[model samples]
Target: MSLNVLAVDDSRTMRDMLNLALSSAGFTAHLAEDGLHGLEVLSEIEPDVIITDINMPRMDGFGFIEALRSDDRWSRIPILVLTTESADELKAKARSAGATGWIVKPFDPAKLVKALQMVAG
Candidate 1:
């Protein structure tokens, strides 16, 4: 099955890289510039998995996760935090906000694909 993915990040390069990696892995990928945009896209696409950056312009990953967890329709979907922050405190915070997993930035494409499949497939 081709798992659908929604990736929220402010970096264009990261979005492009994710698009390439996800498409190469046969996953349908959607990109959003920020958490608010991610929410807007969420209205249109039912993604099995979500990958989001911690820092963003409008709504941060914590807020985004909180919003999703509050919505029954989207609460159970797997969310992976992809960020440059490697601090344990941040990971705990993301977990508290309802993240399913964590991935430090400069992610490996193969590992990312594997993680998505393991969680969403």
Candidate 2:
């Protein structure tokens, strides 16, 4: 089965890139501008996996991860943090917040697809 993904980023360009990449790989892509928008989209779609940026306007990735993890219904969804930040502390924080995996920004589309499959499966 094809995977459904929710990609949350404040940059329209980034969202567009993700859409192109995931869609090209036979995955259904859903876009969200930020954490708040992500939550709204989340309510409508049951994504197999979620990809989020670390910094965002309404809610950052950490806050977003924590918020979703707090809900029993969404807690089990796999979340992957895709960001420019590569700080080990930040990775640790994301891990504690419930992210299933991490991908450094300027992500390779193929690798991102593989990571999504790994996490979702």
What alpha-carbon RMSD in Å does predicted model 1 have with respect to the real structure? 0.6
* Model 2 global lDDT (CA atoms, 0 to 1): 0.95
Cα lDDT of model 2 by residue, 32-73, tens digit: 999999999999999999999999998999999999999997
Report, for every candidate in turn, its global Cα lDDT versus the true structure: 0.96, 0.95
- Which stretches of model 2 miss by more than 4 angstroms? none
> Model 2, residue 49: what's the lDDT?
94
TM-score of each: 0.98, 0.98
lDDT tens digits, residues 77-106, model 1? 999999999999999999999999999989
- At residue 26, give the lDDT of candidate 1: 95
* TM-score quality measure for candidate 1: 0.98
